[model samples]
Target: MTLRTATAGDLTAIMDLERTSFPTDAWSEPMMQSELASPHGRYLVDVEAGRVIGYGGVRAVQGSADADIQTIALAEAARGRGRGRTLLRALLEVARERGAREMFLEVRADNPVATALYASEGFVEIGRRPRYYQPDDVDAVIMTLDLVAWAAHRAADGTALDAGACS
Candidate 1:
């Protein structure tokens, strides 16, 4: 699989992946189109067999050097192959290079896979927003990671954190 920065051309496949990975909370086509055009945002995709198998979105606030992960998902057929973690690490690397010092995201409290992935990536549970996932009314758990530390760990380990070790 190959991961690359997304462009408008990748919108259709991205939406396709979103629909399958997040049936109840998929991002609309326009929502994705806008992100691809945003100056402060980035969208990335992992391609396999010429298809977008997984993707991630993030926004980096210019002045503050803060970044927030908007969403990350993998196609149903792409799960369990560590693609999700790879996409996340790539996004985080983009965040760090863009001068972001911190990163944050919200996940469903019951999404063990996501929560675990975030945790293993050096994210710490900071707090939660009760019933934040309105689509399903599931609580949202907030997690934060210190990019400096994360990078140091990755460097010390001689590579990016392995998704296999997630949670």
Candidate 2:
């Protein structure tokens, strides 16, 4: 798989996977379009044999105290191969580069897979939003991470916290 910064052209494929991944809570086309064009957001796509199989994004304003993980999704076939972690780590790196001291995200309370991924990356549940996911009545699990601490931990473990790690 090849990982790269996402471009506007990747929106169609991103939306395809978005709908598949979040059947009940997919963002509208206009929202996604605006996200891709936003100066504060950084989005990425994972390609395999010329297909966009996964994507993730984060919103971080320069010098912001905190950044938000807007979204992260993988194709059904791409699950359980550590690609989700890779995409997440990439987004965290983006947040750090933008001078964010902390990061936050909301995951579906029913999705243990995603929650575990975030936990493994040093995120901790800080709160929850009741019925944050509409129609399904699923709660949203809010999680946060201290970027400085996370980076220090990764560095102490001899891991490169660089964007090049996305490969």
Candidate 3:
């Protein structure tokens, strides 16, 4: 799949995937629209054959010491193919570009696949919010990544920290 910057024009397709991926607690259209319009927000979508298969977003300000990963979701058909990792890494790179020294996110405790992906990427559990997910009553596993440490690991592993720009 190819990755590129997400735009407001991608809203409908993104909302479709967002609803499908998080049926119980998908974000409302207005909220997403605001996020997409925010100057501090960075979002990306992965497309294949003109279909949106995955998307990720982050909230960061230039020279900030910390950034928060807003969301990351993939179409059911895109799982098990490393698209999540691709999107995640891209987001991290974007955060670093925006001058973030660290990053954070909250993943559903019930999601082993996503949790594993985060763990493999050097995100360590820093805290948890009890029953943070409504309806399902799932806990939110809070994770954080030290950009400096992650970058050193990437360099040691021969992975470019600045993989690519969002656009």
TM-score of each: 0.91, 0.96, 0.96
TM-score of 1: 0.91
lDDT for position 34 in model 1: 95
Alpha-carbon lDDT of model 2: 0.91
Q: Write the per-residue lDDT of candidate 1 for residues 84-147, one digit (tens) a residue.
A: 8888998887788778989999999989999999999999999989988758888899999998
Per-residue lDDT of 80-150 in model 2, one digit per residue for the tens? 99888888888888889889999999999999989999999989999999998999999999999999999
Best by lDDT: 2
In candidate 3, how many Å is residue 38 off? 0.8
Better candidate by lDDT, 1 or 2: 2
lDDT of 3 by residue, 51-137 (tens): 988899999898899999999999998899989998998889888888898999999999999999999999999999999999999
Off by over 4 Å in 3: 161-164
Error of 3 at 81 (Å): 0.6
